[model samples]
Target: MLFLAEKRGQGQVLPPNTGDTCSNVTMLDSRPFSVLSTSVKSEIRKALAPDILAFAKATGISREDGFDLDKVRLDALQIPVNNKKNKLYIVHWGDMLFGVNGAIWIVEVNSHKGRNLIAPDEGRNRGRSFSGWGMQTLSSENGSYPELMFASKGYYAGGGAKADAQCVRKVGAFYKINTCPAGCDDNLNSR
Candidate 1:
């Protein structure tokens, strides 16, 4: 029993948001509002795990301790970078039992440099970079925190202050720091 509207003159029925990836689609039913089937969720996680783990390794977190599978949460919005060919995967995880609270990690897909991770921290001073725990919540526009993209001027302390905010974006495989002066926000400590 399909309860959708059928256009009188239109010959074909097209689903909305066809331009977007099928991963972002949601099927509505009469039962109740919730996530899709477990199989779909599992596939999403399976596809994301490798990339996320690679990012973890790059950030100095060993693959074994990279991310707790039980705690990992994946965001549905997998959008491509504006003009770049790479896509972004937003993820969230935390060890509530251990009192770690919350943390978000961004994964860049199809990047020439393999995997990239962006972890933001508010307490870190701007214009300087340091590596430690996790990132702070700047925005959750697409269900998950997406502000890691705007944390240009702030410190990015992954792997013991490997690079300043200016060099965070260019970080490649194994946390290799690449220089990109154009992406930097400003030379001053804004935060």
Candidate 2:
């Protein structure tokens, strides 16, 4: 995939927006994912805002219903593919006041195409102690894209808690869920 970087005024170059309709921003950094700067994350959020808004709308959530962009949480991972790399970003938001559980939008950005994976109903009963989503690289062999592990934890009613997880791998142009790990009883002693 070829990404052509566009130069703004002065010397500022925006991220490559490529073939995605969501936004025209792309990352120019060649460093590892651990060193992603704040500015890069901001650009990614801006690029993904439209898609996130659309998902929120489809889920019956609106800006008027406490769905502010400032409240959303963003997480990103860089996946190496051959000599190039693709970026995967997760945008999460919720309105517990309105009985809406947490929602997630995962967007994969590359020079060839852009794809999204959404968990419209996720993180329910995620208590105050519950952290946000987590991602791990399951496999990235022989220059091929990797399988990914996504996990989160939440509480059930009656003071019990559970952990949920899924494994996904890129198939063709999109990602497919491979397996759902058994949820753990975090509060078995409460029984």
Candidate 3:
């Protein structure tokens, strides 16, 4: 997707605000998802902040009293499922001062069942014991089903642990951990 950025005085510039929205924003003629807008990005952040915050709280990650909504980056990707139902993966990540915080939320549009599969990743890996997650989906070797994978390389100083897990899509709540090759860390595993 094409993204536009704004320039400021003295050659300072801001990161590309691909999530921005405004009344005058319009889509590019040839691109269905690309948008150009002058206003700040606020719509999705406002709508999803509560769920994000709650996820963090449930995982026991201590965050600052308030988060910078403008710093949040929201990404939506369509997941391929048969004709059964519609699935969209929503990922949100941002800097929360002391460290960065990131979370992935799965939204089942047709069923209206949306939930957080993992807690937000916060603080340094050394301090937190687990590095930030790398997420992707892999097809089962046996051709039974597809799996949403969350992998993390951890710090030995903290606990000498690592995590690799595959979660599958269900009807109501999706992404259940099928296998954790790294021997999951209870504190680090949110699902």
Tens-digit lDDT track for model 2 on 35-74?
Answer: 4454555555555566566656667778788788655654
* Per-residue lDDT value at 146 in model 2: 59
* Cα RMSD of predicted structure 2: 12.0
Top-scoring candidate (lDDT): 2
lDDT of each: 0.32, 0.43, 0.36
lDDT winner, 1 or 3? 3
Clashes of each: 6, 3, 0
> How big is the positional error of residue 183 in model 2, measured in Å on the Cα after superposition?
12
- Clash pairs, candidate 2, are 15-26, 16-26, 17-24
Q: Which predicted model would earn the best TM-score?
A: 2
Two-way lDDT contest, 2 vs 3, winner: 2
- lDDT per residue for candidate 1 within 46-81, as digits (tens), equals 544654454455556663654575345433323223
Error of 3 at 104 (Å): 2.0
Candidate 1 Cα outliers beyond 4 Å, as residue runs:
1-41, 48-71, 74-77, 81-87, 94-177, 182-188
